[model samples]
Target: MSPVNTSSSLRPSSFLLMGIPGLEATAQHWISIPLCSMYLLALLGNLLLLAVIQSDPSLHEPMYLFLATLAITDLVLSTSTLPQMLAIFWLGPRSISFHSCMAQMFFIHTFSSVESGILVAMALDRYVAICLPLRHSAILKPSTVARMVLLILLRGLVLIPPFALLLWRLPFCGHRVIPHAYCEHMAVVKLACADTTANTMYGLAVALFVVGLDTLCIALSYTMILRAVFGLPSSQERLKALSTCASHCCVILIFYIPGLFSFLTHRFGHNVPHHIHILLATLYLLVPPMLNPIVYGVKTKQIRIRVVRVFCVRVA
Candidate 1:
C-alpha cells in the first residue's frame, strides 16, 4: 500500500516538498534513506544471528531458542512494513487504500506485542536462573517456556483483533492523508470520521496494559535478579549476572518509548513538530530489530563466535 511519487494513486501536492514528515516536504522526502538503511542493516544482522544459532548444536538452550524466535519476529516486524514503506517513499503513490492500511497496522502491532512479551519472558528466565539457582533448570524447563510463549501469543491474538475490527468498522471521511509515514494506530485512528473516543480510550488502556505492565514486570524481575546477583559478594559474579540483561534493557527502552510517544503524540501532541513525530515513528519500528541480535550476541558468547566463524570461513 506504500505508493510513491508517480503512482497517481495518491493525489500529488503541487507545492513541491521533499521531507519525510516535517514542517516542510523536504525533510519527509529525505528521512526515508536513513530509516531504510537501518532496516536493511538490522535485517542482515538478525539473519546472521539466526544462521549462527541454527548451525551450532551447542547453542540449543532455552535462551538461544528464544533468541532465534526473537530474530524471526524481528525479521517479520521489519519486513512487514519496510518494503512497502520504502516503496511508498521512493517509487510512486505513497497512498495505501483503507483495508491495506489497516492490515499493516494490525501486523505492526501484533509482532510488536509478541516481541514485548517475549522480552518479559526472557527477563523472567534470568530471574529464575539467578534467584533460584538450584531450581533454574527445573523452573525454566522447555514445557514452562512453551507455556509462557503460548500464553503471550494468545494474549496478543485476542487483544488486537477486535480493536482492529473496530477501526475497520469506522467510516473514514475525515482527513484522508495520514501526516505520519506508517499506518500506526494513532495515525490511522486520527483519520477516522467516526467518533474515536472509544478507540482512543481502549487503545490507551491496552497500551497501559501491555507496555506499562510489561515494563513494570520486567523491572521487578530485574530487581530480584539484581538482589540475587549482589548477594554474591564477589564483584565478578555481579558483573557477569548483570551483563546478560544490560543489553536487553537497552533494547527494551528503545522499543517501548517510541510506542508511548506515538500514543502521546496522537493524544496530546497535535502541535508536535512533525520531525519529532517522524523520528519517533522511525525509531519505533527501526530500533528493536536493529539491536535485537546485538543484545543476544553480547549475552551469548558462543553465538557471537559462531557468527564470526561462519562469515570468516566463507571469506577463506
Candidate 2:
C-alpha cells in the first residue's frame, strides 16, 4: 500500500505497550491538546525563519545560513514522524509498517546528525566571532558555510542509507509490534526476529560517536568562546557575547540533557512508569523541533528582524 519500500505482510503485533483504553484514543479527553498545536506553530515559525533568511541580505552570512538550514532540517525531521504520530494519538491503529518504520528511523537519525553538525558549526562561528572579530567574515564566508553544509549532506547520504538498508535486511518475525510509537531505532530493532546484537551495537556506536562526540565538542568550543568573551576589552562586548550565546546554550542544554537521560533511563532504569516513558519519548521527538525557532528568534536579532521584514513584504 505504501511506496516507501518493499512491503511485507503486516506482522501480528505482540506488544500492547499501552493499556485497553488506548490513551491515544482518550488522549484528547485528558491530555493536553497543545502538543499538536505546538508542532504546527513550530512548522510555521521555521517556514517564516527560512523566508526571512532568504529575504534579508544582512542574514546572508554563514551563521544565519546555517541556522536557516537547521530550520529546514528540523521541519523535515519532525514532520517525518510527528504528524503521523499525532494522527495516531487522535485516531485508531497507531501502527507503522516495516518500510515506513525504516524510513522514519533513517530521517530521525539523519536530521539528528544534521542538527548536531549545525550546532557545532554555530559554535565555531561564535568562536571565530569572539576570538578573531577582525577576520570573522573571512573565516566564516558564505562559500565556506556552503561547503560545510554540503559535506554534512554528502556524509548523511553515504552513512544514513546503509543503516536503513541494514535494518531492512533484518527480520521482524518475532514481535511484530514495536514497544514505542513510530519506528525508533532502539524501539523497533528490539522487534526484529533476527539477532539484533549487530543493530544494537551499531546504534550504540552511532549514538556515542555522533551525539556523544558532538556534545563534547560543542562544550569545548563554548569553553573557549566563553574564555575569549571574558577577556574582551569592554563590558559591552562581554554582555553582547553572553547575550548571543545564552539562547544557544539553553537550546543545546534543552536538546541534549533530556535526550541523554531518556536514552539511558529507557535502557537501564527499572520500573519506569508507562506514562513517564511515553512522555519522555514524546519529548525526544517534539522539544527540539518546537524550541529551535523560538531559540533562534529570541537569541538572534537579525533573524527576528528578517522574519518581520519578510512578513511585511508579503502583506504589502
Candidate 3:
C-alpha cells in the first residue's frame, strides 16, 4: 500500500493496481503462466495474420483489408492490458501514475470501441459480398474500405476520451488501490470520493449505444445474408455461401459474448465472485486475439495456403 507520489487530497498522484483479488499473494504466479502464454499466442497469431494478408496480393480485397484492420485492433487491444497484467502478476501489486493509469484506461476502452466498429464493418462486408455479390466490389472499393477503417478508428478516438475525462474530473479521496488486474473504467472510478453518477450513467450509455448499435448492424447483416443464402437455387451454393460466413460468425461470437458478459457482470453482478469477474475481464481481451487468426487460418482457404507458403519459404 504505497502511493507512487503524494499530491493534493483531491486526487492521489498514483494508483496501485491489485493484480487480481484474493490471488495476488499466492496464486498469481500460477496464474501468470497461462496469461503469459495466451498473450504470446495472441501477439504471434495477429502478427502472422497481418503478414500473411500483406504478403499475398489476392488478399488485398475489401474483406481482407477489414481483416487486417481487425488484426491491428486486436494487437493494440491486447497489448494495452496484458503486459501490465503480467507485470503485476509477476512483481506483485504495482503502482501506476495517475496519468499513466488514465492513458491505459483510454487505450483499453478506445481500442475496444474500435474493435467493435471493425466487427460491424466486417459484417457489412460479408453482407455485401453475399446479398449483393455483383455490386460488392463497387460498394467496398479499396478507397472506400480505407475510409471506413479510418472512420471506425476515429469514432473510437472521439467517443472514448469522455470516459477517461469524466473520471479525471472526479476527485479520488479514497484509497487508490484498484482491486482488479488493470485500470478498468468502472474499477478506477469506484475509488472516487465524489458522486460518480455521471461516470456510471455515461459509461453505461456509451457501452449500450456502441454495443447495441453494432450488434443490431451485425444481426441485420447476417439476417440478410441468411435470407440470400437460402434463396440461392442450389444447395451447394447455399452451403458455399454459409461457409464463407462461418469464420466471421465465430469471430463475432467470441468477441461479443464474453465482452458483454464481463461488462454487464462488472456493472450489475452484485453477487458474483470478484475473481471470476476479473478473470472474465482479463480474458475478454486475450481470448479473441488469440483465437481470431486460428479461426481465420483454418476457415479461410486463401489465408491457410499463404500461411503454409510463408512458413515453408522460411524453413527452406
Candidate 4:
C-alpha cells in the first residue's frame, strides 16, 4: 500500500517578493505612504510635461522632442514596477510566479538600457546645438530624430533579450523569496541554484561596456560643447549655452550616480546589510524617474511658463 499524500506534499511554485527586505509590516505600511505620494507626483509631472510640449507649436523643436521622449520613458519605467510594489505593500500579495518575475526583470532592464541610450542621444543633441549651431537644424531633422528613437528601441531589444533568456534557463531551486522591493535582474539571479557565472559576467559587461561607453560618449560630447561655449566672445552667450545644458547634466548625474553607487554596493559591499543594498538599488531606479520631470520643468523657461498657464487655467 502507498502512503497517503497530503497538503504538506505540495511543492512551492512561486517566489515571495520581499518589499524592502527586513522591514516590518508596520514599516512597510508607513513607507507606502511616501511611495504613493512620489508616484502620483511623478505621474502628474511627466504627463503635464508631455501635454505642454505636444500642445504648443513653438515647442516642436528637437530639444523638446527629446524631452518628451525622456518623459515617456520615465512614465513607463516607473509604471512597470510601482503598481506591483504597492500591491505587495498593501494587499500582502507578495507571491509572484517565476514567469511573471522574469517578465518584470526583462522590462526593468530594457527600460534602463533605453534610458541610457536616450541620455546619450540628448547629449549629442546638445553638442550639435551648442557647438555646431549653423548645422543643428540640418543635422537633427525630424527624420533624424525618428531614426535615433528607433535606434534607441533597437539597442535595448538586441542587448536585453540574451539577459532575459539567460535568466529563464536558470534553475531556481533554492529559497524563492527575493530580498528586494522589485525583481531586479541581479537580485533574481542570486536566487538561482545553478551556476550563474555567465549571468554575472554578462551583467558586468553590459554595465561596464555598454552603459559605460554611453557615459564616455556623453562626457566627450559635453567636453566639446563646453569648449565651444567658452570660445564665444560674449560671457552672456557662454552663460546661456551653459544654462541650457545644466538641466541635461543634472538629469544625467541623477540617473547615473545612484546607478554607480548601487552597482558598487552590490559587487563590493558584502558586509553591508541586505536591506541597504535593496534600498540603494530601488533608489537608483526610483529617484531619477521621480525627479527628471521636476528638474526639466523648473529649469526650462518655456516649460515653466506653460506649467503656470496650466495651473492658472485649472484654478479659473
After superposition, the stretches of candidate 3 with alpha carbons farther than 4 Å from their true spots are 1-8
Q: What does candidate 4's lDDT look like per residue over 1-316, in tens digits?
A: 2212321132236779888767746677787788888888889888989999999999888888988998888888889888888887887648887778777887888888888988999999999998888999999998999899889988888888888778766666556888888888888788877689999999899888767899999999999998899899999998999999999999999999888878877778889898777767766767888899899999999999999998999999
Steric clash pairs (candidate 2) = none
The CA lDDT at 49 in model 2 is: 82
What is candidate 3's lDDT per residue for 101-216, written digit by digit as tens? Answer: 98999988899988899999999999999988899999999999999999988988888899877876677766789998888999998898778999999989989889999999
C-alpha positional error of residue 98 in candidate 4 after TM-score superposition, expressed in Å: 1.5
- Candidate 1 displacement at residue 279 in angstroms: 2.7
The C-alpha lDDT values of all candidates are: 0.75, 0.73, 0.90, 0.84
Displacement of residue 86 (Cα, Å) in model 3 is 0.6
Model 1 residue 31 lDDT score: 60
The residue ranges of model 4 lying beyond 4 angstroms of the native Cα positions read: 1-12
Relative to the true structure, candidate 2 reaches a TM of 0.87
Q: Give every collision pair in model 3.
A: none
Distance from true location, Cα of 60 in model 2, Å = 0.3
Candidate 1's error at 63, in angstroms? 1.5
Give per-candidate clash totals. Answer: 19, 0, 0, 0
The candidate maximizing TM-score is 3
Candidate 1 to truth, TM: 0.88
**lDDT tens per residue, model 2, 150-249:** 8877666666666766666665555665556556677766666667777777767777887877888888989999898899899998999899888878
